[model samples]
Target: MKLTELADLYRRMLLIRRAEERLQKLFADGQVPGFLHLSIGQEAVPVGVSSALSDRDTVSSNHRGHGHTLAKGVDLTGFFAEILGKATGLCKGRGGSMHVADLSKGMLGANGIVGAGLPITTGSALAHKMQRQGHVAAVYFGDGALAEGVLHECLNIAKLWSLPILFVCENNGWSEFSPTDRQLATNLEKLGKAFAMKYRSVDGNVIADVAAAAGKLVGPMRRYPAPAILECRTTRVRGHYEGDRQDYRDAGEIAALEARDPIRLAAEALAEAGAAPDLIAGIAAEVDAEIEAAAEAALAAPLPKSADILADVYTPAEV
Candidate 1:
């Protein structure tokens, strides 16, 4: 990787890390509403996959998608404000953390329903194909969705039509306190083979590797327009949602999480690539300051009024 490219990846990963940490505190302090699912350890998957995509391409994300939203270039201040329920936020503060959408950025939105994004991108991929837009559509789902019927249905449809879509699965091996290995009968690669679609797997902690793999897959999908899968083996450093005790988790795995942390891995890679320790520290400090400022600004913003709630609502509240 070029020094500049490595630096960029390092910086983006650091941003996601700090942003999630800040949001966790906000959720704990009662500043954020609704349930919050965080993708703390799995930052590299979105940061890397999105690095290979263009602004025209669309991304549909699952519940644990704050990292994907930020990686897709959503405004940082607006993202924080959105979660904080500020009127200045994306979606006018209606979507909160789970439903953040910036259509202008091709962030189709994050869904609270598991595996909902699969079918969404399947349709969007068809739209891109019929329109000849040459832009791929991708979805970020977890191992929890691996067993969903929608995943199988969308895979069949996308492969049958040769839709330009990337099914990016961040398999952290757990499905809401239970091991996903115990939940699903087959893995994504095997599942892809069942549908006769292409599939690739990468170390999700390695941002550079995921980017290279995603570029190779997304590159062809842009031209020939075919469906493919990229399964990222990752780690979920936090419980399924905020405030959970995570008593079902393995103690050994919990202790080993710090070693496999994505941010730490990226920073170490930057050091091996000749980045000075001070330089890496400076990058982290810069991201921390940015996150703190964004958090403060978001907290200070005004909340959406109840009387004008229908203003941002596109469809009729009573159809």
Candidate 2:
């Protein structure tokens, strides 16, 4: 990749990192309502995969999906506003943190259900195939969702029809409070092979590695149009939700995960690739300012009007 492209990746990853950090603080301060899921240590998965996707391609996101949504080109202001429950949000504050969606950007919303995105992604890919649009669908889900029966059904159908879709499993080691190994006996690669689908596992913390793998896999899927699975071994720095006690986790696990922070890893790689220290610093400052302004705007934005509660709730019949 060119220097500019690498810089853009780093910038995107940094934006996710900083944005999540700020959200954690905001949630702690009681600014954000409801439970919040932060994809802090797992920035590379979305940044890498999204780098290979076009705006024409669609993506379905899981609950901890701010990074995925942002990487897929959703506006940061609207994202923050939605999380803040403001009227100007992507879903007019109705979707909150777990349901932000922007169809114009090909982001099909972040799902609250564990494995909901799997079938949604498959359906989108099927539509692309039937319409001959040549577009692919990428779905982001966690290790927890791996056991969901819908995932198996989606994979089976995707392979059966050779649909163009990417199933990205962000294996963050925990299925909520329990370790994933304790819940699911089968590994992702084996699961893919069982369904006769292509599979690849990459270190999810390294942004460059993720981008290259996703590009290689997704590029072929767009052309040949077959289902593929990319399992990214990642870390979930925050608890399952904001204010989670997290008594289930090991004492030093979070600290160790922080040591492998994706933003820091990407920044280091960018530096090794000859990006200037000053340039990296400038980008960080710019992202910080952008997020700060977005938060301020979201805080000042009005809440959804009570009188118009049913206005956008349902579709109307054609005249």
Candidate 3:
């Protein structure tokens, strides 16, 4: 990889890491409401794939979607404010942690339902294809979402119509509280084959590996009228949430995964490539400062008012 590209990827990964860490702390301290699904360990996928996308390309994310949005260049203050339900939030405090959306940036919002974003992404891809725009849509989901019939339907239609959509599955081995092994019967790649979709699996823990694999697959989908899937085998570095006792996770599993922290891995790669250690340290420090600022801003923002509850609701026009 080029030095410039590597530097950018390293910074992006660091941003996601620091942001998620700050959010986790805020959620645990009761500073934020609603359930918070973290993308702590799975940060590499979004940082890598999104780095390859232009501003025009769209992305639809899952419950664990904060990292995806951040990687897509969504505003930091607004994102933090949104999760805190502040008046200046991305959704103007109307949507909580799970329902954040920013249409201007092509983030179709984070879905609350399993497999919901797939079909939405398919439509975005169709829009691009119909408008003859050289753009693609990427949908990020977990392996558990594969159990949803909508994923299969979306893949089938996308393949049939040859939509410029990329289906990215962050196979972290668990779906909410249930382990993936208990839920999925068949392998995920097999389904992609059934749809005649081009597919590849990558080490989701490494940003370079992810970017290389995603970059390869994105070209073919754009050049032809086809859809593709990249299964990123990643892991969840933390619990499902702050409250869960993590009775499901094996002992030392989190610690072991921490050893493979994507940010650290990338920094090491940069260091080995003769990049200045102080440069990498400075990048990490910048991200840390951003996280701290966002946290303080989120904490100080005013809560949404009750009178504006129905401000966003709209009635249909007369027939």
| RMSD (CA, angstroms), candidate 3 | 2.0
Model 1: clashing residue pairs? Answer: none
Q: How many collisions per candidate?
A: 0, 0, 1
lDDT of 3 at 49: 94
Give the TM-score of each candidate.
0.97, 0.98, 0.96
- TM-score pick, better of 1 and 3: 1
Q: Stretches of candidate 3 above 4 Å error?
A: 315-319
Worst 10 residues of 3 by lDDT: 217-226
> Which 10-residue span in candidate 2 carries the lowest summed lDDT?
307-316
In the range 1-319, model 1's lDDT, one tens digit per residue, is: 8877988988998899889999999898999988899899999999999999888999999889999999999899999999988998987888988899999999999999999999998998999999997999999999999889999999999999999999999999999889988887778888888999899999999998999999999998888999989999999989999998899987899889889888888888888899988888888889999999999999999999988856745665685
Give candidate 2's TM-score: 0.98
TM-score (C-alpha) between model 3 and the true structure: 0.96
Give candidate 2 regions above 4 Å deviation: none
Q: Would you list the rank order by TM-score, best first?
A: 2, 1, 3
